[model samples]
Every structure is written in C-alpha cells, then in structure tokens.
Target: GKTHLASALGYKACQEGIETRFWRVSDLVLELEKAWKENQLERFKKKFNRVQLIILDEMGYVPFNKNGSELLFQLISDWYETKSIIITSNLEFSSWNKVFIDPRLTSALVDRLIHHAHILTFTGESYRLKNALSKIE
Candidate 1:
C-alpha cells in the first residue's frame, strides 16, 4: 500500500518533469555491491545524485550485512538534504537495528532520514489482499 502511494508520487513527479527514481531496498543494495566489485561505486553514486526524488521500497524485508549496510548508509548520507527520499518500510524505528545490525549506524541513519522529513504510517489489512477479496466477492 505504501509502495503504491510512493510510486504514484514518483510517477506524478516524473510527469511534472522532476527527476524521480524508484528502487527496492534489496535491489539497490545489490546494485551497490556490484558497483563496488566493479570499482564503479563513485559512478553509481553520481548517477543517483541528480535525482530530485527517490522512492526506496521494501526496507527491512531483507537484512543487510555490514558492508551492504554501510553502502546503504553512504547512499542515504549522500542524499541527505540534497534530494528527497520516500522510504516504505514495515519495520518501526526501534526495529531498524535488526536490519542495519549496528545500533550507532542505525541511529545515525534514522537521524539523517528523519531530519526535515514527513513520515506517514499506514495501518490495517494488506491492501492487495483486500482488493483480491473484493474482486472475488
């Protein structure tokens, strides 16, 4: 549901000629890992730097190893205050350590993300399930 909303916003941004990009957290980490292996990490970072808005979907669905976590942190840090990021995560702020592993790094990442940010929480049954049931009825 949150991913749907975020993607809609990204689409609207694109329609308005704003530079927008969307990536699932796991895929983004994998891309970063590949970039690091190919020694093109800087190029990867530069590619996203100019985006006006980035939607990071499905955070906390997969936990990151230390290296992947650091890479994600670096990406977030780079985008901090420069570009808008809409992150859709099922995990609460307290559970973020489960994903990042390091408490301090998680804290720092949360701090950077929450600064000058608007957070929206969605509660209730899965929208996809609800839609499926409605169609059957």
Candidate 2:
C-alpha cells in the first residue's frame, strides 16, 4: 500500500550493505535548504552520494519553492545513472510536472529515473483505514 514503503526499502538496502537514506520530500528539501544557508551544501551532497539508494517518500505532497525545485533537480542530475533513487509520489507520471514545476526538468528526471528503475504502483484502500474500520466492527 501507499505507506512508508520507501523508508522500509531504504532500511533493507542499508542492511544489505548498500548505504541508504530515507527522507520525506518536505523534510529533505528543508534540510537541503538549511545546508545551503549554513554553507554545508557540499557536505550534504557528499552525504547523499555515499548512499547507494536514496528513498524520497511522499513526493508531490508538499509544494516546493524555486530553491527547493532547483535543489531537487540538482540532486537528480547528480545521481543520474550513478546512484539509484526511489521516489514515492501520490501523483501519476502525467502529473509529475506539477511537482517539478519545469517541463524540461521533469522530462530529464523521468528519463533518468525510469532508465533503470522499477515502478510499483499500488491502488486500493489504505491499509491503515481498513485496519481501523475492522477494529470498529
């Protein structure tokens, strides 16, 4: 289901000796912005580079400013084919332009991400809500 599967995948990858980082899209953007403001941008990218897989959870849930969009595009460009990134987005491929803001950037990102990526789409009732309903019954 559409839970924190990205985070779980990251943890599993890390356990298999592949460095991984799990971060929500909003939190990741905020942290990256902070690093930029604090003169730690390079350090932040380095940290990101060390990870074999970076799982970004809840993409498209939060809107991004220009800086955030640029920062995210930079990350995607830097990791293109060199490292794997897993993005869990509520939006479909057609709607990715909304999150990315720029059409060119969105195309580049989709191309790179889909080049060697496996997409798993889940559509159903959320497990949490189903469980809660069962409990009430």
The digit string of per-residue lDDT tens for model 1 on 1-137 reads 89889999999999999999999999999999999989999999989766999999999999999999999999899898899899999999999999999999999999999999899999999988999999999
**Model 1 spans with C-alpha error above 4 angstroms:** 130-137
lDDT, candidate 2, 116-136, per-residue tens: 888899989878889999999
For each candidate, what TM-score against the reference?
0.93, 0.85
Superposition-based RMSD of candidate 2 using all C-alpha atoms, in angstroms:
2.1
Query: How far is each candidate from the true structure, as Cα RMSD in Å?
Result: 1.9, 2.1
List lDDT for all candidates, in order.
Answer: 0.94, 0.83
Per-candidate clash tally: 0, 0
Best by TM-score: 1
